[model samples]
Target: MTYLPLPQPRTTPVRVMTIAGSDSGGGAGIQADMRTFALLGVHGLVAVTAVTVQNSMGVKGFHEIPLDVIAGQIDAVASDIGVQAAKTGMLASSAIIDTVAGAWRQQGLAGAVPLVVDPVCASMHGDPLLHPSALNSLKEQLFPLATVVTPNLDEVRLIVDVEVVDDASQRDAARALHALGPQWVLVKGGHLRTSSRAPDLLFDGTEFREFDAPRIDTGHDHGAGDTLAAAVASALAHGYTVPDAVAFGKRWVTECLRAAYPLGQGHGPVSALFRLNE
Candidate 1:
C-alpha cells in the first residue's frame, strides 16, 4: 500500500472580529465586514449586536440582540478562535455598548487587540441606526478603548456636537473626536459638497494627515463606511501600523467604490470583491 505523507497542519490565517449589527440587505454591518475580511485574506469572526430590517431604500426596523448573548459570542470567539483586531458598528443602544465594552475588558483584550470603531449613527439612506439616548454611552464607554474611530460627517457632528460644513470644520471635528480618547480619529469628508475631492482627515491628537481620492459620482456606496473600517481592522490584524492600515483601507475603499454596481432600487453596495476581477 502506498503510504501518503501525513497531512501537515494548516497555517492559520490572520483572524479579525466585528462586533456590529446584521443587515438583512447584506450591504452593511456583519455582512460587509465579513466580505471585507475575506477580500483581505483574514479569518472573520462576528458578534452581532442587532439585526436590522433594511434594504437599499431605507431601514425599516431593527432588533437588538440580548446583552448576555452578545457577550457570549465575543467570549467564544476571543477565547477560542482568537481575535487579533476588531471593529464595532451600529451598536443600537447603551446596553449593547456597555456589554461590548465590558466584554473587551473582561476578555483581557484591552491594549492587545486593535479596535476600529465605526460610530454608525445613521444609515446611508438617512435612517437612524442608533438610539439618540445611546450616543453618550457609546462615546464614554467605547470611544476611549478604540484604537481608531471612523466617523462620517454626520456622525462626527453627532459626537462632537459641531457643524462640519467645510474643510476647516471637518478638521476641527477630527480634533474634537480625537480628544475623546481614541488613539486616532478619521473624519470622512465624502459629504463635503464644496470640494471635488473626497478628503478624509486623520488626527492623532498631535498631527493631522489627509487622504484624498477622486470623488466617484455614484450612488452605490451604501456600505462604504463598514467596508472601510473592516478593511482597516483586517490590515491591523496583519500587523500594519494604524496609519498604514488606514491608508490601505482608503485605497481599498476607493477601488471598491470605483467598481460599484447597481443592485436594489435606491442605492447599491460597493463591490467588496472587486479585487477578484482584477
Candidate 2:
C-alpha cells in the first residue's frame, strides 16, 4: 500500500542574526555568535561588516566591508528569511553604523525584533576594532534601537563617559547609559575592578539586577562578549524573558571560558558549543 504524505514541520526554528565582523582567529565576531546560536538550538544568520585578521595575541589588520554591501546583506536576510532577534558588533566606521541603523529604521524592525548591541570597540588583546569616529553614530543611532546594550566597563566609559570599575560606579553607569535610550543596559564588570570576583549589572530602566560569578582566572576568553550577546539574542528569539535570557547567557559564557582550549600563542576562544557536550 502507498504511504500517506508526511507532515510538514510544525514551526519555524528560532532565527537569530548577527551583524558583525569576521575574525580569522575564529574566536570572536560572527563566527562565535553562529556557534553559540547553533549550540542553543537556534538558527543563526550573519551580515559581516568587516574582515579581521586576528589571533589570540592581537589583531593584525582589518578590512571594512562597503556600506552598500552591508546594506545589501541586511536587506537580503531581513526581507526574505527575516530575523526574530539580532545583535550588532564591530561596525568598523561611522558610515557603516549609519548604514545599518538606517536599514533597521527603514525595515521598521524597532519593536518587531529583539536587538542586542555589543559596542565592540577594543578587542580582548587590547586592539581597537571600532573607529573612534563611529562611537558617536553608535550612541545617536543604534543605542536607541537596542533592546539590550552589552558593554564592558571600558566600553561603558567610551559610550557614556562614566566609570564602571566598582559596584557604585556600575550602578551609576547603568542608569546613565539607560538614559541614552536602550530599554535594558548591561554593564559587564569582568575586566575592571578585577580583584577576586566577576560582577555584572543589568539595569532595566527602572530596576537593577546584579549577577556575580567567581572569576575564572584564565586568558582563554577570546569571544566572551560576542558569545554572551549572541546567546542573549538567541534566547530572546526563542521567547525567553530578558532577565532569564541574560542569566543563562552569562552562565553559558562562564562555562565556555572554563572549558576554553589552548590554541594559538595568545588567548584562545571560549567554546561556544560547550552546551552540546554537556
Candidate 3:
C-alpha cells in the first residue's frame, strides 16, 4: 500500500465578543478588537455601540446606535453564538452602557463569562468619546459587572476620583476603583511620563502586580488599548489567570507597537498582524 488515509480531529474555536464602536480608519475600536482576536486564534464577535468618523489625525464625529439595536445585537450573540470571554469598549453613551449591563444581568451571563471592561473614556487625540453623564452611568451600571476594568491614567482619574501621577498614585487609584465592585482593576500608565518603559498596574482587590515593558517610541499607535484588552480576554478565555493574562498581554502589545507600520499622516495603528510569519 502506498498510503493510508487518517481522520483529522476538529478543534473548537475560542469565542470572544467585543462590545464597542467602529473606527472608520479600521485601526481601532471594533475593527481592532476583531483583528486582535483573529491574531490570537480566537473567533471574534462584536456588538457595535457607535460609528466613528475618525482617522490617525483624530475623531471627526460619531453616531451612537439606538439602544434597542445594541441590546438586540448583544442578546443575539450571547444567546446563540455564545462566547468564552467578552470585552466592552467605547460605550458611546449612558444609554448603551445601561443597555449592555441590563442584558448581561437579565441573560444571567454575569459570573459565567469573563468580562474585561476597557473603560475607553476618550481618545488619545484629545477627542472626547464618552460624555460626562456616561461616566456616572459606567460606574453604576457597568463597573460592578466587570471581571476586570482596564483604565488608562485619564480614565483612572474618572473611575477612582483621584489623580494618578506615578506608580504609588496608580496603586492608590486602583484600590479606590476596586471599591466600586470590579473583581480586579488595572491602571494603565501609558500617559505618564517615564524614562523608557511603559508600566501598567493591576490591583486584584488585594495585591498589586506591575506590568512593565520597554516603551516603543511611536506615534503611529491608535488601537493599542483595544489590542491589549482583546489579548487579555483571549488569554483568559484560554484559562490563563489574570496576572498571567496581563503579563502575556503586555508582551503581545509590546511586540505590536514595536512592529507598527506607518499608515496615515498622523497617529497610526499598532500592528495586530505582526505574528503572521511566526
Which model scores highest in TM-score?
1
Report the candidate with higher lDDT, 2 versus 3.
2
CA lDDT, every model vs. true structure: 0.89, 0.87, 0.86
Candidate 1 residues lying further than 4 Å off, grouped into runs, are 1-9
Off by over 4 Å in 2: 1-11
Candidate 3, residue 96: Cα displacement in angstroms equals: 0.7
How many steric overlaps does candidate 2 have? 0
* Global lDDT of model 2: 0.87
TM-score of each: 0.95, 0.94, 0.95
Clashes of each: 0, 0, 1
Better candidate by lDDT, 1 or 2: 1
1-278, model 2: which lDDT tens digit per residue? Answer: 11112224685677888999999989999999988877776778888899999887889999999999998988888999988999988998999999999988888788889999999999987789888998989989999999999999889888889876678888999998999899999999888755587888999989899887879878788899999999889878877888988888888888888888878898888896555565
Top lDDT: which candidate number?
Answer: 1
lDDT of 3 by residue, 1-278 (tens): 11111223476678889999999998899998988888777889889999999988889999999998999988998889888899999997888899999988887889888999999988989798999888888998899999999998888887667898777788889998899889989888777875467889989887988899888888877899998999889888888888988888888888889888887888889987877766
Q: Which window of 10 residues has the lowest lDDT sum in candidate 3?
A: 1-10
Report the error of model 3 at residue 152, Å: 0.5
70 Cα displacement, candidate 3 (Å): 0.6
Better of 1 and 3 by lDDT: 1
Note the residue pairs that clash in candidate 2.
none
